[model samples]
Target: MALDETTRQVNKRAVAALEAAVWGLREADVSVIKAVQPLEDLSNVTNAHDPALEELNALTVRIRAAREEVRRRWIAESEGER
Candidate 1:
């Protein structure tokens, strides 16, 4: 293969890997949110909050932010922005 073709193949693989990782992390976050939703609902019923759940919710926000960053970087890189 030509050098440019080889480079493109490598970049494709790298992008695929990055996409898989980012999507997997997002899926895990969804799973965690689903798991904790019941607990949060119970807290609402009792008018109380669980610290661990609160922290997990905060962590979810951070993870979402990270995913957004990753998405932006992915788009930039795909557009040949280095």
Candidate 2:
């Protein structure tokens, strides 16, 4: 059966959130690599705080939450249709 407009919209939002999460992870990975590259030659390394990393982490969390919300809504709607 074809999905109704609301369901289609939910699915699209879910997909977009998933894509954003993936992209965020990739960006985070790159940031981490860049941050560590300078210390690669050093024997002793200390943890350093980075604002970019923090922001990316927050963004990833939000994206996952959005995805979960979409899934929950879709499941609830499907169940209601039965």
Candidate 3:
């Protein structure tokens, strides 16, 4: 079936949004791996109040914030929202 121009535009946007979502997930995965490397280096934290642990917590917050925005934007685009 031939799609109308509007439908074709929407399909393009959706494909881009889905690709963004996939990239966002991959970025999050890499962030987790990089953040966890410090734990292995520090031997699972020298103490409960370790600096590496603190840094990891910060990175988690940052990654979560970024990923959430990507997810929201992708959902909005998929739903035909500008």
Candidate 4:
């Protein structure tokens, strides 16, 4: 069966968030491994540096939330069908 508009939108957002999290991790890896000067320049110097690392952390949170939302909605839908 086809998903409703709201469900479809939630699923789309979840997928997008997952993709973004993956890309963010890759970017972080490259930033650390390649020692990209420009990317490094964007980081603050005060101990808590690394903008890519920060971005990856934020993306990880977003991905978890999105996946949980998708799972919760899917479970609700499945229960409703029974």
Number of the top TM-score candidate: 1
Global CA lDDT of candidate 1, please? 0.79
What C-alpha lDDT values do all the predictions have? 0.79, 0.58, 0.72, 0.57
Q: What is candidate 2's lDDT per residue for 23-68, written digit by digit as tens?
A: 6656665665665455443323443544445555566576566656
lDDT of 4 at 2: 52
lDDT of each residue in 1-82, candidate 4, tens digit only: 3568788676666656656655665565555445545445556555355766566556556656665655555555545541
TM-score of every model versus the real structure? 0.72, 0.46, 0.54, 0.40
Better model by TM-score, 1 or 4? Answer: 1
lDDT of 1 by residue, 24-50 (tens): 878978987897788788886775658
Of the two candidates 2 and 4, the one with more favorable lDDT, higher being better, is 2
Model 2 scores a TM of: 0.46
Model 3, range 30-72, lDDT digits (tens) per residue?
A: 8787877767577654665476666777777777777777777
RMSD of each: 2.7, 6.9, 4.8, 8.4
Clashing pairs in 1: none
**What stretches of model 2 exceed 4 Å from their correct place?**
1-3, 44-82
Question: On a 0 to 100 scale, what is the lDDT of residue 51 in model 1?
Answer: 78
The 10-residue segment of model 2 with minimum total lDDT is 40-49
How much is the lDDT of residue 3 in candidate 3?
66
